[model samples]
Target: MAQLIDLKTFTDKRGNLTVIEKVVPFDIKRIFYIYGVDESKRGGHRHKQTIQAAICIQGSCRIYNNNGSSEAYFELNRPDKCLLIQPEDWHTMDQFTPDAILMVLASEYFDANDYIFEPYSAV
Candidate 1:
């Protein structure tokens, strides 16, 4: 199952900075981003080995994830909030605002074999 986590934020007049280090669930290896997304579009798959932490760096979006037996919906609105997705969790990201930008930190490099295409049942 995946969990929504509050990232550590540092601020002192130089704006706020969000940090997710090795102390988090997994060590980051691959960094990718998605933006200019349409509200009607969605991410429609899951991973087999890659662990992911998704953050909405620009605007708000909702992630629909299913953990085999159950499902849940998580909102990514703040830059300091991260949603950790495990290998078996089937997920789809949709309901994106006009200016939404999503940043993902992965535990491994891109490997096509690690991907799983599964239909999600939102809860």
Candidate 2:
């Protein structure tokens, strides 16, 4: 199943600083961001070998995850909030705020065979 975690954050007079380190379970090979989305949804599939950590660096968005037998929903509204998506967890991102900037750290490089578009129920 996907897990939601809080990133370490430091706040002071200068503002807030959030850091991503030591917590991710895999070595990151790819980094990407999603922004300027309309009402449409994104990520309607799971991965075969890619684990991902998603952070809403700007605004907010809702994520739906299903790992075969279980399911969960996560809201990433802050830079300090992260959603760890396992390779087996099927997920979708929606309900994005206008200014939402979702950054994803991936465990593997791009491979067409690594993607599974079918839902868990269909599998």
lDDT of each: 0.86, 0.95
* TM-scores of the models, in the order given: 0.89, 0.97
Q: CA lDDT of 80 in candidate 1?
A: 91
**Model 1 segments more than 4 A misplaced:** 120-123
Compared with the true structure, the alpha-carbon lDDT of candidate 1 equals 0.86
lDDT of 1 by residue, 1-123 (tens): 889888889998889987776545777899998888875757678888988999999999999889787888999999999899998888899988889999999999999899889665454
Per-residue lDDT for 1-123 in model 2, tens only?
Answer: 999899999999999999999999999999999999999999999999999999999999999999999988999998999999999999999999999999999999999999999898842
Q: Itemize residue pairs with steric clashes in candidate 2.
A: none
Listed per model in order, the count of residue pairs whose N, CA or C atoms clash below 3 Å is 0, 0
Q: What RMSD does model 1 have?
A: 1.9
